[model samples]
Structures are given as C-alpha cells and as structure tokens.
Target: MKTLNDLLQLGDPRLYEVCEPVQENELPMVKEWVADLHNVMEEIRAKYKFGRGIAAPQLGIMKRLIYLNLNTPSGSVPYIIINPVFENLSEELFELWDDCMSFPNLLVKVKRHQSLTIKYLDENWQPKVWKVEGAISELLQHEFDHLEGILCTMRAIDNQSFKWRPTPDSN
Candidate 1:
C-alpha cells in the first residue's frame, strides 16, 4: 500500500546531506530500505508503468545505497548498489529530460556523459563494476547525484530547461 509519499520530497534538507557508507551491521535496516524502495517502485510502476532506480536518501535513509529495477531488452534485472563511486566518465555528453521521485511532477533538462564506468558494492557487500551507457548510464547519474545531495533540478542545463511534468493526455 506504500506509495510515493514514503519518499522524501525535494524540500527536505536531509536530501542535501551526503550519505554515509553503509556498514556491515546495517544490513538488516538496509534490507528494509531496499524493500521500501522496491515497494515504492512497484506502486509507481503499477500506476505510471515506468521506473529505473532509487537511492536510499530518497527514502530518508541517509546511507550510500541504491536499488535499480531495470527493464532491459533481454528482461528485467534488479540491482543494489552500495556506496557507489564513479570510476570514469566518457568525454561525450548528451542532453536529456530527467525526473525524480523526490520531485515527481517536474522534469529537468540536464546534460550528462554518454557513458561511464562505475564501481560499487552489491547487496551482498561484494564489489561490482559496470561500464554503462545510454539510459542506464543516465539513470545511474541521476540516482548517484542524490547521494551527494544533488537533485535533477540542480543539474538542469539552464533555468529555461526546467519544466513541469506533462499529463498523460499530453504524452
């Protein structure tokens, strides 16, 4: 029954604070956070039918953890990125419209690297590295920014590029 209200909104200052690296003992709570994230995503998907990922901070848990339920051409793949850090970024950049659960009704036009290398710990606390491009790469950047207390609005290319989310009828 949990929905987007479970997520922290844009005005919450806690979203601006950098999250701490999750520790071993925090697994129990981390799991709960992950569950909450999944539930929120599921609720959103059932209604909106689209989502990619979410960060712990979005749930008001200031830990360096993120969950992704990606819909790939092959199939759906779930991910848990703990304490993620970008290893490299491509020189190429592209502009795209981005949205966030924190500010669900707004879309921001932002420029991001076309591709990048990222390293992080999995849900099991195991190390993981990925060379991501296109939508996945963009998705990671958006979620990662939350760990640094940055929002898509902050990443917008210009004041004019920011916009309100469109109604389904408009789409």
Candidate 2:
C-alpha cells in the first residue's frame, strides 16, 4: 500500500504530464490504484489534517482517476471518479485557498467555478453524471486540473497569492 511518502511532490516532471484516460480493459486494475490513492489521502489527512481528494497522477500512476472522500452532514462519502469529463461550468465563480497533497505545506489562492456538471465512470465502470456546487465543485475542479497536467499554483490569482500553511508550532 502506498503512503503519503509515495505522493509525488510539486515540481516532479511526472506531475506535469497529462494523464491518459483509464481504458475499459484497465478497470480490473483500477481498484489497486484507487486503493493506493485512498491510502495516501488518508495518510495525508492524518498527518497534515486536510485532504479531500487525490488524483492518480499524484502517485505517478499517470492515469485519469480521482479518489474523493468528502465529509457530508450525513457521513463521510467516498467516490472513485474515472475519466471524468466536464459537461458544464457555471459562469459564477468563487475563490479559495486551495491546498494539495502534492505540496501539503503551501496554499494557492485561485478562482473556480461555483458549479459544474460532470460525466464519469464510477468504480463499477458504469456511467454517471453529477451536478455539484460549492466545496465539491471546487474540489472536483482541482482534481480534474491534475489530469490536464495543471496545478493550482499555475492558476494563482497573482504572485502574491502563494502562502505557506501555518505549522502547528507556529499556530
């Protein structure tokens, strides 16, 4: 099982390359990849205390896969999104301090669509569509950008938009 140590950090050339879509034949192997992503995300959350989603490329898998474990009012819901395609994006936009497992110590202030519709294959390789807004929308956009070899730092509002997360000792 892969741990947080296995996560590719910012500036890794592999993270800058566009990921390939998960092929139908690879569905059987996707489970292992998802497991690795989940383990790494969970390890990140345990150590850094913040992690909502992770993309396969972050693990050097170079495949179009994202694992999200969102905490909803009802409970923590996990999703394995494969080969996601954007169907729509709302004109309304919002900005937030986005953090990533790739660079856990820094935060990048960036703009993101307030809402988006996406079509993707689920863990079972079944097609599904979802319309998400607010935090979920922002999270999805962040992960989707990874598939295109884009990082939040590249989308920073400006040079001044970069900042380091306060360490526990500092806080």
Candidate 3:
C-alpha cells in the first residue's frame, strides 16, 4: 500500500518532468499503478482532509495517467484517465483557490476555463470523452496540468495568491 510519503513534493525534479503517454502494451501494468494512486489518495484524504485526484507523475510513475474520485449526490465516482487530451476549452474563465496533492498544505489562486471537453482512455483502454464544467472541469484541468509538468503554484494569479491551509483552530 502506498502512503502520502510516496508522493513527490514541490521542487521535486520528477514532478517538473512531462509524462509519456501510456502505450497499449502497458495496459496490463496500469492496474497496479492505479492501485498505488488510490492508496496514496486515500492516505492524503485521511490526513489532510482534502484530495479529489492524483497524477501518476506525482508518484514517480512518469506516465500520462490520473486517478480521480469525484463526490456526487449519490456517492463517489472513481475515474482512471489515461493519455488525456483536451478536445475543447471554453473561452470563458473562472478563478478558484486550487489545492494540490503534491503540496497539500498550500492553496493557490488560479484561473481556469469554465468548461472543457476531454478525450481519454478508460481503465479498459476504451476511448471516452467527457464534457464537464465547474468543479469537475477544474479538477481535470489540474490533473492534466500535472501530465504537462505544470503545478498549481506555477499557475498562481499573482505572487500574493498563495496561503497556507487553515487549521481547525484557525477556523
């Protein structure tokens, strides 16, 4: 089982390296990787109380993959996105306080497209496309950025657009 300690922190050179697309031959190997991602994501959620998704590069996988567990009215839906490509991005933008699994204790204000159309391979290596907006769109964008070697900190609205996560006492 993976732990939060398996995650690459900010300033880690591996996190800054662009990931390679997952090839068909490697489909058999993705299950274990996804499991590792899931394990670490759970650890992050239990410790920091916040974690929607995680990218493979964050764990030194060096592959274009992301694991997202989205909360819905019914329950959580987990998605394993492989080799994702942004098919479309809305012209309009929205700003939000975004946090990352790589830097769990920091929040960065950044602007992201209001909506996006993404094409990616599912866990079965089947093609899938999702037109998403709001929180889902934001989450996908954040994970996709990781595949491109971009971090939320690099997208900060300004130098002052960062703050530490507030503790229970501070709240």
Which has the greatest lDDT?
A: 2
After superposing candidate 3 on the true structure, give the runs of residues whose Cα lies further than 4 Å from its correct spot: none
Candidate 1 local lDDT, 1-171, one digit each (tens): 345787788899998989999998887777778888999988777766567898888878889998999887999899999999996799899999898877777888999999999999887878999999988999999999999999888888988988887866685
Cα error, residue 3 of model 2, in Å, equals: 1.4
Error of 3 at 79 (Å): 0.4
Clashes of each: 0, 0, 0
Candidate 2's C-alpha lDDT? 0.94
lDDT winner, 2 or 3 = 2
The pairs that clash in candidate 1 are: none
Error of 1 at 44 (Å): 2.0
1 or 3, greater by lDDT: 3
| Error in Å for residue 118 of model 1 | 1.0
Q: After superposition, how far is residue 87 of candidate 1 from its true place, in Å?
A: 1.1
lDDT of 2 by residue, 26-141 (tens): 99999999999999988998889999999999999999999999998999999999999997799999999999999999999999999999999999999999999999999999
Q: What is the C-alpha lDDT of each candidate?
A: 0.87, 0.94, 0.93
